[model samples]
Target: MSAAARAHNPMPVLAGAVLVVMAAQQAIVPVLAPLARDLELPEWSLGLLMTSAAVMFTLTSSPWGRAVDRVGHRTVLLSGLSLGLVGMTGFAIVCQLAVSGVISGELGMALMIGTRSLLFGVAMGAVPTAAMAWVAANTSTTQERVKGLAQIGAVQGLAQALGPASGFVLAFAGFLGPVWAAPAVIAFALVAVAVLLPKGPSRRARAAAAAEAEQAEAAAPSKPLRPWDPRLWPVMLGGFGSFLTLGLVVVCVGFVVQDRLGYEGADAVRMTGLVSTVVGLVMVTMQAFVVPRLGWPPWRMLRSGIPLVALGAAGLMVADTLVLVTACMAVLAVGMGTVGPGYVSAPTLLVGPAEQGRVAGLVQTVTGSTFMIGPLGGSALYGINDWLPFAVGTGICVAGAIFVWTRKGPGETATAPAPQPELAPDPS
Candidate 1:
């Protein structure tokens, strides 16, 4: 196909590849309990596994973003997928060892942390950074950028719904079945990416582009951006607040179902699953359908979403029945769906193309950090009082809303220059 055609429509291939990888990652959720039981590990050990992965993900993202800028998206993406495949295979082997009494429970858990958590976390960071960088590079207009990024998030939402169900069903095949399935899924994604993604800019073309960017930077020099840079503060703050809220809800919801709603064991698990599915579907619907049609700028979306999140958290604080809780959670989902794409796209608009990868990485890093902080913080507050977390989350969301409202929207561009000297020219 022609370059124009590829540029015009890379989403299908990118979205498909991302969906597969994300599904493979999320599939672990359903099998966590079963794996813990079979391996004779404590349930809380699973939480530690997840937390370790999040830490790796957070630490690696910025570097991976820099790699995407240096090596090109396809190379980084393929490498990440390969790492994920190896990681998943290793994790499956560890599980099989535990089941067969070939390894002690402590050793098995250690192997899981090394493979599934650490290795897979690095892959998670690489894939999303590459995907977002690809979108930012391919899409010319602001609206197109929003649509492309939103579609990525929509696919993730779909995967969040599909992965657990598929994993649960596959578990009937045996202890190793679901564990092994993740590598197979990633292998498919790797092949799809290799075949479908167009050979992006050639080495010479990238060199020329880089040289041009260098000249532009020389003409108007600017300082490097820090994590706490003023231009980036709003986007980072908004993302941290949004994901913190999400993390709190995700961790606490099951507890709330069991403790507050008088459900227990299998019933509580089923209810939590049902609620999660509904939230995922609502998020997918909003990002895929509602966002594209709204045609609102990123700033406007942020302004609108933050307040809704605050309101939803407040509702969840008072909700007693399952139906009421579901409604409140749905509200939170909508708010999250709206804010996510905007938080991603807005920073790209303010800078030049050269810095897209770095910005994408920084954004992912902030998000990862929140997931790490949110769950532990929420769990602690919930232990104190169920209402405390929600009340605090509501306050956080409201503060985010106020900050975003007072700032300039997407129409207002910041003076931050794209990363120029730091990014090596792409060489195929």
Candidate 2:
């Protein structure tokens, strides 16, 4: 069907898929210590497991994005979810075996990392890449695109807020409970995608679509842009800086709760969870309610958000009480809420529809890279001095503001690309 004729919005299904996948991925986080004990591995080894997953997630995103562009979003989404199901199930079985004394320690750790960390990481990269690409391809107007992306971000934030709590609650059943639950969640997502997501064009139709798109692009004065084109650097850097700041705060805040606020053990954990939940709520509120109402352009959102983030980081630096810290972190979450959708949507405005998958992949790659670097970097800086990570994050946010402020907003052609047909799945 033509772009003008495409009326159904797939954002809800895509967002639902993202929520389930992210929840499953995050559900294991709160149980890592228990998992370590159950598997008879050191606590730090579990940390390595998480690090390995981040590494794989970073490496696989771009390729998966490119695949979405080729094979279609529905195909890629289902494929990724299938992989996740397999990975989660495998990891759970490994955990069960280790706990039951059916597998040795070293072998079990290796198997767990292979299935849970590496394989699951690859699936993690694929799901979001396809989902974002689906959003970009399905939405015809900038307003629609921004709203769709914001919804995705909001759902993801909600999932992050609820995932750990679910994990902690499920632990009462057994350590393997959360582990097995991840696959079941992914299974449901797989069914939802298969049933609800619109089908893409057939091979011949896609070929024709590509040809027509290419002809239109050639006729237009402006050319198609690559993901790494200079015009997109501002958006890319803005995304990286925003998430890097977030990573720093996530890793360092617990230490601050313990050392600075005199909270420790379960008290420290509870305080940290409370702060994170508050942050997630703030982010969800902004993205879901505040951003759509404002409807500002992506560049404008970035300009407004970056300074707030810097100020929030500065607030964290001086905060001496839990109340003060929570207030500061709320400020930080507000900034992130503003920045997140803008970062995702801005690049889509710059590129044509054909490039959306690649750009979305690049955005996810930046996020994954920050996750890998931020915690380790923040921990190192914290080791040097308690205040160091927040200070450095402040600098990063300030630099991000300046970087975005200098870049030109979307040009006329970029603001309104030719209406290409939606990349829906085959209806048959």
Candidate 3:
């Protein structure tokens, strides 16, 4: 179907589905300790669970993009939910039944990692890519697309807030019980998608849109998009750096609070949880209220966000008390909140509509890559000094800002990016 003739679609259903995927994924963080105990594995070995899932998420996103392009978005999304259900069920069963006497610790860890990865590969498949693509496809104008992207960002932030908080709250009720919450959530999400989703651009709609486009052939057409447009790299680099910093922070924060500050395990977890709560709330407010009021280009937000992240990380280097750490985290959250909305919108605006899935996937892949590397790097650096990871992570953010600043085009802050010409609708 042609892009111009396409009508704006209500995509709240798809956003809700993506939120389910994220919730399932994020729930594991708070439950990991109980999982390790149930499986009778060492902390180091259990770490493989995340490593495996991240590896899968990073490797599979592109193929998932291709699959969505080939299959319908709804089909692929259902497939992902099914995979998540199976993976979570497997985790539940394995934890309930696996005999440490027979399975051996290393082997058990390996099994958990494999199952976790399989689950992640499926649930995460089309979510990030398809959800955004659906938005870009259905939305009729650049302004609407920004609104769509902002909502997406807000939903993701809400997920970050609720997912772990819910898990932890359930954990507070009792150990191991919270871990069971994921399956139920996934199941409910599947049902919601089934009921709420529109049958996705109908065949008749596609054909009619296509016919109208041919009739308007004499009209002046928009310029073809340059996928490798020079402005793209700075934006992309900033995104990569931001995720890298985030990745490192997630993995290292607990260790810093415990080892460096001489806190107990519970204290460390609470501190991290508090930081997450603040970050999530701030993110929601920024996207919902602040971004709209300014009407500023995304690049401007990115510029402000990157340096704030640096300041937050730098503050972490000196923070010795919970209050100090919390304030620093708040600073970091503000920086991240500023940059995040813009980063989410960057590839969508840059690549045009036709390639939204592939390009958005590529952009999300940076996030996946950060997940793959950040934990490992942070853990190793934490061994050297608990403060070193945040310090170095801050430096990386600074470098990314410098790179973005040096680039051309009035700070490269695009107000309204061009949209792609629509492609022939897939029959699959």
Model 2, TM vs. native: 0.75
Tens-place lDDT per residue, model 2, 196-233, is 88787688876665565557446555544444578787
Q: Encode model 1's per-residue lDDT on 1-428: one tens digit a residue.
A: 22443544556876887787788876666455445555666535665777778888888877876676566777888888888888888988887888789999889999999999889888887887677766665555555565667777778889887775566466556645667889999988888888876675777776675566557557553555656866677777887898898876666676677667886534454565566667778888888889878977777888888888888889988889989988998899899889987887777766666555456667777888887777667766777788888998999999999888886764356434344233333323
What TM-scores do the predictions have? 0.77, 0.75, 0.81
Winner by lDDT: 2
Give all candidates' CA lDDT scores.
Answer: 0.74, 0.75, 0.66
Residue-level lDDT tens digits of model 3 in 43-125: 44434566667888778776765565445567777778878888877775554445434556566666666666667555676
Superior by TM-score: candidate 1 or candidate 2:
1
Deviation of model 3 at 139, angstroms:
2.7
Which residue pairs clash in candidate 2? 198-425, 199-424, 199-425, 199-426, 200-424, 200-425, 200-426
Candidate 1 residues lying further than 4 Å off, grouped into runs, are 1-11, 33-47, 69-71, 95-108, 139-147, 168-180, 194-222, 255-271, 297-300, 314-325, 348-358, 380-388, 401-427
**Angstrom error at residue 86, model 2:** 2.7
Candidate 1: pairs in clash? none
Cα RMSD for candidates in order = 4.8, 4.8, 4.8
Looking at model 2, residue 10 earns an lDDT score of 66
